[model samples]
Target: MEFQATLGQIVTAVIGAGLQLRYLEEYPEPFWRPGDLSAAAWRGRLPNAFALVASRPG
Candidate 1:
């Protein structure tokens, strides 16, 4: 077997904001459709919930 080593090698990827992911504790799948999720799934339905992912590799 042959092996290759990588040191401090960084790849590239994309990142964006205003993204939201809502999963259920009982079942990870959405109650309805895949994207048919609201911001008020866990809390008392305040207003908004979101997540931000880094776009570029640092």
Candidate 2:
């Protein structure tokens, strides 16, 4: 959300670059501790970050 690009835009750009998307997943918890108590507790909410797996064309 912070970035100007949307998730769909990013995926499209990656695909356009000749990389195939293998997997995409959202994290359940913050990778790092946040100052907010809710985020620090990782209360099973929607993730703020995500994991994307892409591979170059074979």
Candidate 3:
């Protein structure tokens, strides 16, 4: 599959929607590496997955 927007774009959109960024983690490879079942083997790959937590103001 192809990505329409980038990480920065997604973050910007979230901020624009009035949500505050709390945590952000980027995985250097697909979170579920189909080929490499071991973490050590996939540790040095390029990032393709993102994990983030955002919240709205009280």
What are the root-mean-square deviations of the candidates from the true structure over C-alphas?
Answer: 14.9, 3.5, 4.2
**CA error at residue 58 for candidate 3, angstroms:** 1.2
In model 3, the Cα lDDT at residue 4 comes to 85
lDDT tens per residue, model 3, 1-58 = 9878989999999999999999999876665667646665377566768899999999
Give lDDT for model 2: 0.78
CA shift of 47, model 3, Å: 0.7
- The whole-model lDDT of each prediction reads 0.32, 0.78, 0.82
Q: Taking the tens digit of each residue's C-alpha lDDT, what string does model 2 give over 1-58?
A: 4757767898999999999999998777667765666653378676656789999987
Q: What lDDT score goes with residue 17 in model 1?
A: 35
Q: What TM-score number comes out for model 3?
A: 0.68
Model 1 per-residue lDDT tens digits across residues 1-57: 996432112111121232232321232333344365555543434422223233323
Model 1 CA lDDT for position 52: 25
Best-to-worst ranking by TM-score: 3, 2, 1
Q: List residue ranges in candidate 3 displaced over 4 A.
A: 1-3, 32-44
Ten contiguous residues with the weakest lDDT in model 1: 6-15
